[model samples]
Target chain A: MKITPKDVAHVALLSRLEIPEDQVEKVTGQLNAILEYAEMLNKVNTDGVEPTAHVIPLSNVMREDEVEVSLARELALANAPEQDNGYFKVPKIVEG
Target chain B: MDYSVVIGLEVHAELKTKSKIFCGCSTQFGSDQNTNVCPVCLGLPGVLPVVNKRVVEFAIRAGLALNCEILPFSKFDRKNYYYPDLPKNYQTSQYDLPICVNGYLDIEVNGETKRIGITRIHMEEDAGKLVHSGNITNSNYALVDYNRTGVPLIEIVSEPDIRSAEEAKAYLEALKSILEYIDVSDCKMQEGSLRCDANVSLRENEQAPFGTRTELKNLNSFRAVQKGLEYEIVRQAEVLDEGGKIIQETRSWDETKGITLSLRNKEQAHDYRYFPEPDLVPLQVSAEWVEEIRQSLPELPNARKQRLMEAYGLSSYDAGVITASQAMANYFDVVVGHGADAKAAANWLMGEVSKVLNASNISITEFAVTPENLASMLELMQKGTISSKIAKTVFEEMVASGKDPATIVKEKGLQQISNEGEIVAIVEAVLAANPQSVADFKAGKDRALGFLVGQIMKQTKGRANPELVNKLLKERIN
Candidate 1:
């Protein structure tokens, strides 16, 4: 469970980060400290203990079947980096 | 190249409650962007979540419907993660002690009953939607809309019991139908109401150890879930065959490209840094409360299917179709409540009514044909006021214009020609004109009876009573 410097480098690559070399060492130390604490969980006797996924015992959340109004085109496109008409603008996704 | 596919489904359904699970924000979909949001939903500082009572009730109802055991007490936990769409850095989900556990949903595929194990059903708040601006090409920065944030969502996780793509699709459909029947959620995949993530892996038939599985994300439709699993199965199988290890990872299905690309390395169960939620109090559900919710639970899909078979004397297939949604089943009862024949109503609802609903891409609730109107339409048919053909025309007009059955029948002048003299004249004229059928009927060819009846009904412009016409034809033949 020891996250070494090389391990952090690989994890960062998998996570799609462009970390500078100096920062990689710093992040590796930070992640290792976190993992060391997380490893303490192995000490607890989880044998036959169910892993908890949610605190509330519930199921079948639903809504009524109806068509409500959608946001206006302007609102939908407000945060877009680029747009045309009502659609979000993007680079050519496909070649002609 | 013998292999078995192991598949599991994680379904996230937005519950049907009027308000968000943790806040007072409206759970309505398609509201103005961010209009349904509040400080709690936006994760503003100083706002704390107040668990919605209806959220717990709906969950208990769902657990009962799925035959899950409700825990006496449960608590929420923080699943810490950094994501732009999640206004809160961490999602408040159940880390352990989910609301319900140990349930099974029996699904039928190709006439075989496959019992899929339900691991857990837990409540959580949904993340906001990320609106990626610009075209598919060079896109501008994306905007995050928190309208859907904090909506009540129940994530139903099933044990990996599925073995094929078709079975995965069947499981989703059956689950959606059950949810729809209980009126817990709309379960519309197109509206981002119900979404699915399929976990897929391939192994040899007798392999002791399972192969690495890939999680395919954001499959919004039944077809997509099936197709995504199928593609991943093929992809993993090919990888393993080449003596390459199948990587554990999260993958995205490029539906247009028909390939799954790795999105990120798979996070182990410990990666989320789960801890008990500090803001909300631990939920204490009493047995009496659980029993009350269980008793209040509506008749689910299977139970309703069984009753329809017994009470209405319908075939199993007919019952299954009619009981797919509570709304449709209740609509049928209303028609039957008004004294229309159950079998006739079932046939009409399954046939012409369902056809129109599908063609227009809407549910029965959206159609203008109310239960009373449908009942009266059937009444017209029973009383011989309109022939089946005329009844269909009137039913369409009733649905289109929201007109009453009698009004449509009156305006269309579709009364059945039950006059005995008028029917006898038409029968006599048809018997005289069709000498071949008359000769065939005399020779006792059983099908010739149908030909003679057709001739009379055609001559009468389909207005004659089919039963009376048949009786007259049989008597004349004798």
Candidate 2:
């Protein structure tokens, strides 16, 4: 599970991080250290152990099967970076 | 070289908890962009997450629904990542231990039942949305909306048991219907509330180790999931057949081109650098708590479908359609509860209501038709107060104006002509007018009987009772 310098570079590209070429080495070292610490988990005899996806086991969480109030136009657009009237404004999504 | 496509799905459904999984932020969809958010959800400096009790409860409910074994003790882990959508540098998700494991969903494909094994159902927070700026291809900047962030999500990962695109779609549809029936999520792909990512690979036969699988990410619709997986399967098969090594990578579906293009190489599972989330405490679910959730759990889709078949004598297709959405199923029950015929109500819902909703691209909730209104309309039909044809007309007016069924019937004067003397006179006149049809009916041209009935109905202005008219017409013709 040791992450090489190449691993950091790959992860950076996948995540779209603007990492400078020179800083790749430094970031790789830091990442490798984190990976090394994480490797300690393999020390447990988890051969038959199950992987956990959720902490609690329950099923069939449902509402009352009714439609409640929808967010108002103002509330829906309140935090938009840009808006026109009460609608969220975005650049034209289609080309003519 | 021919090959078989092997597909698996990882569906991420937002749980129906009132709050976020790891924070107290409301799990409500369509909330103000950040009004439901809190410091913990924002991942502010020095703030810690307190696991929502309902998150665990919901996860267990999902597990139980899938018939998965519930872990006695499960814990959260930090999945390290950096993205604008992810407020926390690391996402709090289950890693080494999940709430539910080793479940299976039985889906029918082409009338054959196939059981897809569910590997796990893990809980996590949903990321925020990224709205692109000027251009989608090359946007200057993207606006981040955190309303979706911190919303509880359960990722249901299935084993690679599916062998075709149709099977994949069927499995997803069955899963979606079940989730909707259980009231977990709206499971609306358009809303990004229920999303699917598919993993596809092709194999020659069972003897080989698995091929390098490509992950198709963020397919918002079932059609897209099916098409994306199909395209990938073909693309990978062609590549491997040409002696090209199939690269393990994540790809994006270019919906316009109907093709999948490379997004990024597959990240190793270990690349996540997962560790137990320190801020949230390990969840200890009591047996009593699990039992309580189980007791509170509604009848799942499969069980309800069976009950509908047994109790109401509904056809399997009708039962399946009615129970597809919890809302629609509950609506069906309401109408039936009001003394409407099961088969009759199912016919209207599956035929009329569903048809209208599908054509309008609206949900059942968007229409003004209530269950009581539908039941009363059907009752009018049963009581011989309105002909079936007239009932439909009255029902439309009811939908448009939300008027009472009786009022619509009264206003429209759509009552059936069930008076025996009146019906017999109309039938006699029709028979006398259609001598050729009466002669043909005597000659055993059964279709001529239909013509006679049509004439009588037309004379009565489409409100003639079909059963009564037929009885009178038969007697008069004889």
Each prediction's whole-model lDDT (CA): 0.80, 0.79
lDDT of 2 by residue, B290-405 (tens): 78878877888878888999999998788887887878898999999999999999999998888778988888878789999999999999988997889878988887899989
Residue-wise C-alpha lDDT for candidate 1, range B303-367, written one tens digit per residue: 88889889989987888888877888989989999999999999999999999999999888888
What DockQ does candidate 2 score? 0.09
CA RMSD per model (angstroms): 6.0, 6.4
For candidate 1, give the lDDT. Answer: 0.80
Please provide TM-scores, in order, for all candidate models, with all chains considered together. 0.80, 0.80
Q: Write down the worst ten-residue block by lDDT for model 1 chain B.
A: B133-142
